[model samples]
Target: MTDPASWPQESASLAEYGEDCVKQWNNVSLRYRMPLRGFFSKRVKDAAEVEDLTQEVFLHLIRRARGGPIEHVEQYVFQVAANTLRDWGRRRRARNQDAHESFDAEMHQPVTDISPERVLLGKEEIKRVNAVLRGLPERTRDVFVLRALEKKKYAEIAVMMGISVRAIEKHMAKALAQLGSVVDKAGEQD
Candidate 1:
């Protein structure tokens, strides 16, 4: 068995470890590269990602060997490979990569129904709504904006406004009644 103390330290360059250490490391890498590729290929679907993961495993092994000699090189390599795969899985999940869809220009084109008449009608409706909202009491308007635009629950809005949930419900009811009347009037005009 070789002495662990003789293994390369962080301070020692790979060249200082002599050609034999380099050759041994190269041999170990070559022996394990194909197996590591197979290991990654079994789990990852993307060919590029599998190759990148296989390379990452060897990088980890190199870093570990630089720290000190591994007692069981084969076992250590596979362990690192397993850990690398697990980390990759965690990253993929965090990024929500599984839910992503590739974009195609034809499929993602902008809607063609935005005619000038529709746009002008939308603007007039927004102005009418804004005028009504402005005429409302401050608290009622605030409750309306918080619930409608911000999508806050009644309890959440109550907590935020330092009011009771019942008060929140009352305010929301009043705001909705006023808005509903405005919508009815607008429909009559149309």
Candidate 2:
């Protein structure tokens, strides 16, 4: 499989375009699954929502591939993922607004899951990581989420975040530093 951090390469021949494109996308999907998983994992603390968003990411890639000659397919995919996330966030915000208007906060029902302890703990860890994400500067978090977690190329991240590729790299470096500090503190707690 191709490294997830690498961009999609051009097709060797036009006639074999479909095959090459599918192969490239599949390779990327397999490799970048971790990064995509991580990004959505943070964006939506819920496992179910993350799973659904990841599926949407791949599906969007497939649709975008249908037209041919995406000079930088990796960048395109990241852009799509970011845009989709924005839409999801808007919908969630709207729903929350509606809920607030409809019912008293204290009267809200709590969601409960009676799953095994391990599953619950894993979910809790995801929530913690997500909370850490919230503490990051917006651009830093996006860069970190896309580059470290989604394994996206710097060019792709820059395009999605609408900044220079170098900015993306620098943001990633800072984000990693922050993450390391947090991890160290958490370890000390343990």
Candidate 3:
């Protein structure tokens, strides 16, 4: 004899509930897993990833079912599978974009020495410029070399030389004008 409220009520334990959901998912998912695998295989090359994605679909169904029994299991499962694939696509796009960014950085610093002849010509030009620079007045040569070879800004050169930016600019102009004539003479020699 038991009170009406205390009478044995039918309710599955958590483990039993989970097992029931898994069994149902297994039975229903078998029919669709092949189709889902085929669908995933078209986009993903690795069979293992396809299989893993398929299992993720079932896992999603199991988690969702834990909330309550789904009324339309097939439709729900397919929808979840589609969402999983979309998520994978988004991740792959982000990964590829990151890879392309690294590739672009490398591309910006290309190995410009594509030919030995170009290398030799560049070296010769540098030698001629060095000879011309040596012939310049000490102050002009220092200013020009700092600005050109060392790639210092005019303001920086001014600070280092204890001169004004305007003075550095004038020195650069005079250096270029003199180098122009020197380059012309060198060209004639060549």
Candidate 4:
């Protein structure tokens, strides 16, 4: 059986070990904290981030120290700092944080105007185009819709319609001429 009187001595030694560890950490912090800040600040932009990274480096050191004594604390601390920075960069990239831009209403304004006047004009234009499409011969309308709306090549359209390439070209020309006339008339009215 263990002696109960020896328990106090063991507890005292454990307390001394704890104190020694604390003192060592305090010395390491005092010696390298500013240097670590400089190391991070040279690579990182934000002051807050530099400080956070510095704290992260110390946290890594503390965790690693628990496992065993570091032979070269300076080298280990720097390596840990570099790894932390790289990890932070990777996470920032994964989140698209680097691509984020601050919102400025004037700078980020919509490219297209969606005002009432512009919307009404756009609706009217669509109506006019639809009216022209409705007036076209069925084959010509089909060719125009296939080429313009469906984005089919002439050869593809010809194959689909079972028409010759020359015939397809003629139909496209006719459709374009009718649409051109409508556009020209609209331009004059405006």
Candidate 5:
């Protein structure tokens, strides 16, 4: 692991959000690129495109890593990579006219088709949800979105959120309990 900076100022300086960072990550990408491509190609059965997708994954990581702080650098990088794969699945399904929507899309999108009446109801529910999320001691919103929105696995979320799988389960429990009641109540009425 790299040395942790003493302060945000010092850390901020280390922000290599520059050409060098992209180059560095690209090198790393090449190292793992083939194996990763091979692995995904088997399932997706698109060997030719896998290489390009692998490069895209690293490119995205480079962009995001440049934008801001990453609590666990390695973990965050891989999580981003995994999500890229999930996004591919979503696109492919949409292309094939598959009925099953990817969890990835559902989780990323905010509740849509909200009617005025529903919004009024959801207003309080949204507040309650915000409150519930805010009540969470840590980054509950992020964790919840990654798992629920992105449909990312616990291990992926844990790495991205920098929490343990056990902790991720616990956080989701509280998050769902609070938010679920609100959603369930809304769904029950008419």
Candidate 6:
């Protein structure tokens, strides 16, 4: 190889291209932020998260624009936003799927046909669950809530909590074992 260091890192006119792209992005950034935020807000209620996602969209566009001059800035921005939304949806679905896979068969029971006795039992069950959850280690409880209640995938939970997926699975298993024992004892009493 002829000198790796001397090889052109980027195009000779890369700075000019980048500068023009930055100008284009600044010109259209404000006009699109509101609409992008609105779109993200519809999917999630958190204002902070919506703002973050809107910023992410712009960042993605900026990266793309730096590669070449965008002939149609508005269209490209919206297209990037749309792609971002699709990616968000895919990740959400995958997380939901991971949560579902971790659940046992009892969790899949249909809830449409509610009986008076069933309602009473459900209330009692909720009380037991809350008590058991309160008794769990802090991380265990958090893992349980995110996986079981929030329906987050183990991988997603890992990323959010800055832990490993195996750790998340361990926490879930511990939580389920504890809860299962409590539920079993309660059933015996009945």
Task: State which candidate has the highest TM-score.
Answer: 4
Per-prediction TM-score, please?
A: 0.47, 0.41, 0.42, 0.52, 0.36, 0.39
Q: Return the number of clashes found in candidate 3.
A: 0
Clashes in model 6: which pairs?
A: none
By TM-score rank, best first, the candidates go: 4, 1, 3, 2, 6, 5
**Worst lDDT 10-window in candidate 1:** 9-18
Candidate 3 local distance difference test against the native: 0.75
Residue lDDT tens for model 4, 47-98: 9999999999999888887887676566667789899999999998999998
- Tens digits of per-residue lDDT, candidate 6, 1-190, equal 1233432333332232233545445545645678788888888776986887899888887677567755555566667877887887788798884355555777887768789998898899999989999999999999999999999999999999999999999999999999999899989988
Off by over 4 Å in 5: 1-23, 69-73, 97-190
The alpha-carbon deviation from the true structure for residue 177 of candidate 3, after best TM-score superposition, in angstroms, is: 4.5
After superposition, the stretches of candidate 6 with alpha carbons farther than 4 Å from their true spots are 1-22, 97-190
Q: After superposition, how far is residue 168 of candidate 2 from its true place, in Å?
A: 65
On lDDT, the stronger of 1 and 4 is 1
Q: Least accurate stretch of 10 residues (summed lDDT) in model 2?
A: 10-19
Q: All models: lDDT?
A: 0.82, 0.72, 0.75, 0.81, 0.66, 0.76
Residue 165 C-alpha lDDT in model 4: 84
Candidate 3 least-lDDT 10 residues: 1-10
Worst 10 residues of 5 by lDDT: 1-10
lDDT of 5 by residue, 25-123 (tens): 544454446756765687665566677677776777667766764454445555766787888888877788456554787678887777898768757
Runs of candidate 3 with Cα error greater than 4 angstroms are: 1-119, 177-190
Determine the C-alpha RMSD for candidate 1 after optimal superposition of all C-alphas.
Answer: 9.7
* Model 1, span 1-190: residue lDDT tens: 1333554433433343335777766656566689899999899999999899988987887787778766656666788899999999999999999999989999999898899998998899999899989989999999999999999999999999999999999998998898899899989988
Model 3: per-residue Cα lDDT over 1-190, one tens digit each: 1132432234322232224655545455655689789888997887998999998987787787779767545556568888999998898788884365434776688787679877786788788777878888899999999999899999999999999999999989989988898678768866
* Residue clash pairs of candidate 5: 107-149
Expressed as tens digits, the lDDT of each residue in 62-167 for candidate 2 is 6765776555555665677788889888988888843655566766867565569757766766777778788889889988888777899999888887889888
